[model samples]
Target: MDEMMPHSHLPAVGVADDEPSLAGVIAEDVAAWCRRLSSTLLEETGESLLGKLRAEADILRTLVDGEGSVVDGQPQAPPYRDRKGRLRNQTNPVTSARNPVAPPMALVGSDGESEFSVVLPIQYQGPPKTLHGGYVSVLLDETMWHAVRTALDGISFTRELTVTYERPVPLGVPLTVRGRVTSTDGRKTFAEGEVLAGGEVCARASGLWIAPRR
Candidate 1:
């Protein structure tokens, strides 16, 4: 009978013993033990630990390439692709709009007190050539929220917002909205905002924001 050829690359599995070869059985047991241990660590430590492990695994990957050794785990990559269509390279979208007199006002300042401005075009008219009252209200709301954030500490959400239009905001000119926090009481904060054009206040607003309960 012909003798079995030894695998040069792979380590021998069987051990010389009177009983059945223990190398294969021991390796399988060790692998299962490692899997169970990793699962337990993940369950106890949560996702942060997993993220660190993934980063470390990536660093170790260079050592194993071209060695005919394949790690059983998948490569860690971001869920979304980048603009260039490469794996793991991605960017968050810009949150601010080009124009301020619109829904979903864009954030404009690094500090809590933020100022945003917009030029009223002829197309955004209420009557003949004046800006719409609704558009003015949107600016007031955004300004008030920014003010509230500036005055208070921690995160806050708007509770009640009220605006009073003083005069008609003219079109074909730039309108500036300034927001600042007036006062705060525990979780509740009070804020004031105003829309100005040509150094005159066209609209004014006051609002309350409540900090989320822990």
Candidate 2:
């Protein structure tokens, strides 16, 4: 019961083409087919391999993409790295990699603080290899609303969060999430987070954000 759920900083930006485009290689090939169907939906046991993964998601949902195949102007902005922050969030599904139910995130420090890393495969398990206390409280309520929207870049909304599990988060390793902003009043804002691994600290969080009125 790794009392789960989970940033600070805003100075690690980078990404000016240099490479990867073609819609970032088709959104990392659909986030690597959603990390290989989230690790084969947690180690496929049977049912004819889960009916061939629902018949390959119904033949990849007919190769979606329409509306004149978008691309008429802007709205593609894809850049997300956290360790050496190079951020951007085209309709976040946690850094949407074509939103394959998102497990994507690579945000890193900047301004008020933020950081990321997650490895919750095994279908985001729970009680066994851990992680799944409401998905660690929505990963500490979306990293305390992206640490007050990347320190007042705008938008925020997690009016409360308070996780506190001190251990047991080990489903395939890597786990480090952080958030910041420990103050602010009018329109309320206050955040905190933690969920380390090898370096200890299992879980910790604190939040209450707002920021509506413009």
- The alpha-carbon RMSD values of the candidates against the true structure, listed in the order shown, are 26.2, 11.3
Off by over 4 Å in 1: 1-95, 98-112
lDDT of each: 0.55, 0.66
Q: lDDT of candidate 1 vs native?
A: 0.55
Estimate, for each residue in 49-144, the C-alpha lDDT of model 1 and write its tens digit: 777667646534433232222334222111233345433311111112211212223346535576777665554578777878977776776566
lDDT of 2: 0.66
The Cα error of candidate 1 at residue 167, in Å, is 0.9
For each candidate, give its TM-score against the true structure.
0.49, 0.39
Tens digits of per-residue lDDT, candidate 2, 29-87, equal 55556677767767776896789799768645532332222333322435556654455
**Which number leads on lDDT?**
2
Residue 87's lDDT within candidate 1 is: 30
Q: What is the lDDT of residue 120 in candidate 1?
A: 54
How big is the RMSD of model 1?
26.2
